[model samples]
Target: EWLETLPQDQLKCLVDEVGKSGKATRTVKLPTGDEEECTFLPEHVTNEKKKEKQTTTTFMPGVVEPSFGIDRILFATLEHAYYARPKDTTSEDKQTRGVLAFSPNIAPYKMTILPQDQRITRDEKYVDMMRKIRQRVSALGHSCTVDDSNATLGKRYARNDELGIPFACTVDFDSLSDNCVTLRERDTMVQIRLSVDEVSTLLHDLCWGRQKWDAVLKKYGQSSQ
Candidate 1:
C-alpha cells in the first residue's frame, strides 16, 4: 500500500528493481511517528503467512523547505545601493565618484558632521559646537560621525557620500554666531539652514520617516551650496 503512494514512473522503477531482488529497502514512518528502514516485498512474491508477519508503515507527505541566503541578500543590497556619479566638468577635478545610496534606516551612519572649511575645523568654538551637535544626535538614538580632516568640504562630503551617510550638518564661521548649521541631504544634494537644536529633531524625524524631504524644502526653502 505504501508503494502505491509513489508516482507512476517511480512506482514502475521500484517494482522492476523489487521484481529482480524480491525485496526493496525503504525508509517509512511507523504509527508512533518514528522512521526506520524496512524491507518491502511485492504482493505476488509474498504468501499470506509472510504478509501477516510484516508490519504496516506510512510515507510522509511532501513538504516545503524555506531557505535564506545571507550572502545573496547582501550582494543584492550592495548592488541596489551602489552607483557612480558623473564627473563635474565645472570643477577643477573631473573624476567620477562612486556613491552608496542606502536609505537612512539601512545606512550605518544616519548623519555626518562636517566643517565648512579646514580653518573652522581647528577653531575651539566650531569644535565645541560640533561636539554638542553630535551629542544631541546620539541622544536621539541615531549614529553620527564628525569629519575634521584637512580635506576640502567637497572632498569630505564625497567621502561621507561613499560611506552612505544620508545627512550632513556643516558648521561654518556663521554657526559660531547664529548657532545655525547647513543641513545637506545625500541623494538630492539639497541644503537647508537650520538652528542646532532644530537640526537634531529634524534629523530624527527624517530618519524615522516621520517627515519628507520635499515638505522640509517647502517650509525652510533651500540654502545655496
Candidate 2:
C-alpha cells in the first residue's frame, strides 16, 4: 500500500537495497518428514510496482495513530464498578411501596384517570372525555388506559401503581361541573387539580423528560425540589 502511494524513484531504490541485504526464509519440509526453511530470491527490478506501495506506507506524512483494545477497556470498567458489601440479616426494613422511579415517558401509562363514582364509570360524557385525552396523548406518542371498573379510587390508584403508571387523574364530582381533574404524581405523592384539557399535555411533557418536576411545580404554583 505504501509503495503504491509513493514516487517511482523512491520506491525502486528502497526495494533494491532491501533485496541485497534482507534474506527472506520460508518453511520447507525435510527428507525425514521434519521441517526445513526456504525463500524465493528477492529481485529488485522484477517487483518495482510493489516497492512503490511499501515506500508510501513507511513514510506516511501528517499521520496520527488511533489505537485501542476493546476487551481490555470493558474489563477495566467492570472491575471499577463492582461492589463487595456484606449483607446483614438481622436488620429491620421499612415498607418501601416497591416503586420503580422512572421518568414519565417510560411509564406504561402517563396518568391513570379515575372516575369518582361507580355511576360515572362508563358514562358517555366521561368515556368521550377520556377518549379525547387518549387521542391527545397518542398524537404526542404518550400512553393512557381507561380503568372503568367499580373499584374505589384508592384501589384504582394502587393497581396503576403496580403497573408503574407514574401519574393519576381523578375525575371527581368537581370535574363533572368544572371540567377539571385531580392530577396525582406517583413518586412524590403530590396532587394538583388541573383542567381535563390541560393535564393530558402536561403529563405527556413530564413523562417525556422534556419538562422537569420544577417546571411542573412552577406551573401549578407548588413548592420546588
Candidate 3:
C-alpha cells in the first residue's frame, strides 16, 4: 500500500525516452531493493525573440501548508511528565501521590517561599522579609513566589509538586530571632535549616544543578528526608 505513491508503471516509459530527450537522469536503489528513476527538469530560459508572446505567471509570496498542533504537543508533554506511586513501599517510604517531574529550567516557578504563619502574611515585617527573599532570587534570573494561601503547608507543597516546583523555603517564627529558614526539597521531601543569608546562593546552586542535594546535606545537617 505504501508503494501506491510511486510511479512504477510510468518509470519504464520515462526510462525509454531519456536518451532522445537528452535529459540528465539517474536510477536510485531503494532500501527495499526497488529502483526509482528520476530526472531533473531543464532550466527555463527565454529568448529575446519569443519574450513578447510568452506569458508570465503570478504567484503568492511566502505561502506555506500550515499544520501547527499545540494540543498534541501539550498532551505529549503531560504524558512525559506524569509520575505515580502505588500505596506499597518499604525501601523508599513514600505515599501514593501523583507528581509531575519537570526540570527546574522548564518549571513555571523555580522556588516558592512559604510562611509558617499564613495569618501574618500581611504583617509589615513578614511582607518585607518575603519581598527581600523574592528579590534576591529574582536578581539571579530565577522566578520566586510566596505561598501565603490559607491552606496547610503540606497541602500547598502537594499542589506545587504537581506544578513542578523544585524547591520550597519555609519561614517560621524562629527566623525572626535566628535569621534562618528551613529549605525543603521536592521529590525527596528532605528538609534542612540554614541562615537566611545562605538561602539565595544555596537555591541558585541547587536549581541550576551546580550543587547536589546530597552535597547540601553533607555541608549542612539534614533535618530529615
Candidate 4:
C-alpha cells in the first residue's frame, strides 16, 4: 500500500530494492480494518510516525483593530511638534512664546514673507518685492504666506512661529535696493541673507532635504538680527 502511494517510477525502484532485500510479503491491516498483503518497510513506517508527531496546531487570540482616523493622527503630530520658547530675560517683553516647531516638509507654510516694519509694509516697492518673492516660492511648489500686518516685526515672527512656519523671509529697504532678503529658520532663529533669485530653489532644497540649514549658514554666513 505504501509503494502504491508513490509515483510509478519511484514505486518501480522501491520494488526492485525490496526484491533485492529478499523481504517476504506480509499481511497488514489498514485503517479500514481490512487485511492487506504488502512488503513492509520499517524505515517508511518510522518516517510516517515522525511526520504525524511533528504536526502542530496554532490558535489566534484576537482580531486586528482598524487604523486611527486622520483627525487622531493630526492631533498626535501637532502634539509632537508643539513647544514653548523660553522668555528672553534681556528683552523688555518677558512672555513665553509658544511655537509649533514642525519640520519644513510637514509645516503648513514652508516660508512666510514678512515686511521689516510698518513703513516698509506700506511702501509700494517693498510690497511689490514681497509679492514677487512669494510668487517665486509658490512657483517652486512650496506653500508660502505674506504677513503684511501692522504688528511689530517681533510680534509678527512670534505669531508665525505659533503657526508652525518653518522659515521666514523678511523684505526690508535694503532688499528693495540690493535685491536680497533675510531667511530665518524657526527652531534656531538663525538668519542668512541671499539674493531674491535664489530664494525659491534654496527653499525647495531645504523642504525636500536636498540641502540642510547648517550648510546654508556655512555658505552664506549668518546675518545679524
**Candidate maximizing lDDT:** 1
Sum up the clashes in candidate 3. Answer: 0
For each candidate, what TM-score against the reference?
0.68, 0.53, 0.65, 0.69
* Tens digit of per-residue lDDT, candidate 1, span 188-211: 999999889898899989988999
lDDT of 3 by residue, 1-225 (tens): 322344755544444454447554657567798988856333311112234576899998896756757888877777898787455555464665677777776777888999876666867786787788889999998898888889988778877777778889888877777888888878777889998888888888877889988889888988642
Native-to-model Cα distance after best TM-score fit, residue 197 in candidate 2, in Å: 1.4
Off by over 4 Å in 1: 1-67, 90-92
What residue pairs are clashing in model 3?
none
> Looking at candidate 1, what is the lDDT of residue 56?
84
CA lDDT for candidate 2: 0.66
Per-residue C-alpha lDDT of model 4 across residues 1-225, encoded as one tens digit per residue: 544556766555555565567554656668798888887464543222133457689998997776887899999999999999887788898788999989899887999998888899767888888888888888888899988898988899999999999999998878877899999999999899999999999999999999999999999999995
**Worst-scoring 10-residue span by lDDT in model 1:** 44-53
Candidate 2 to truth, TM: 0.53
> lDDT per model, in order?
0.86, 0.66, 0.75, 0.85
| Regions more than 4 Å wrong, model 3 | 1-54, 58-74, 85-96
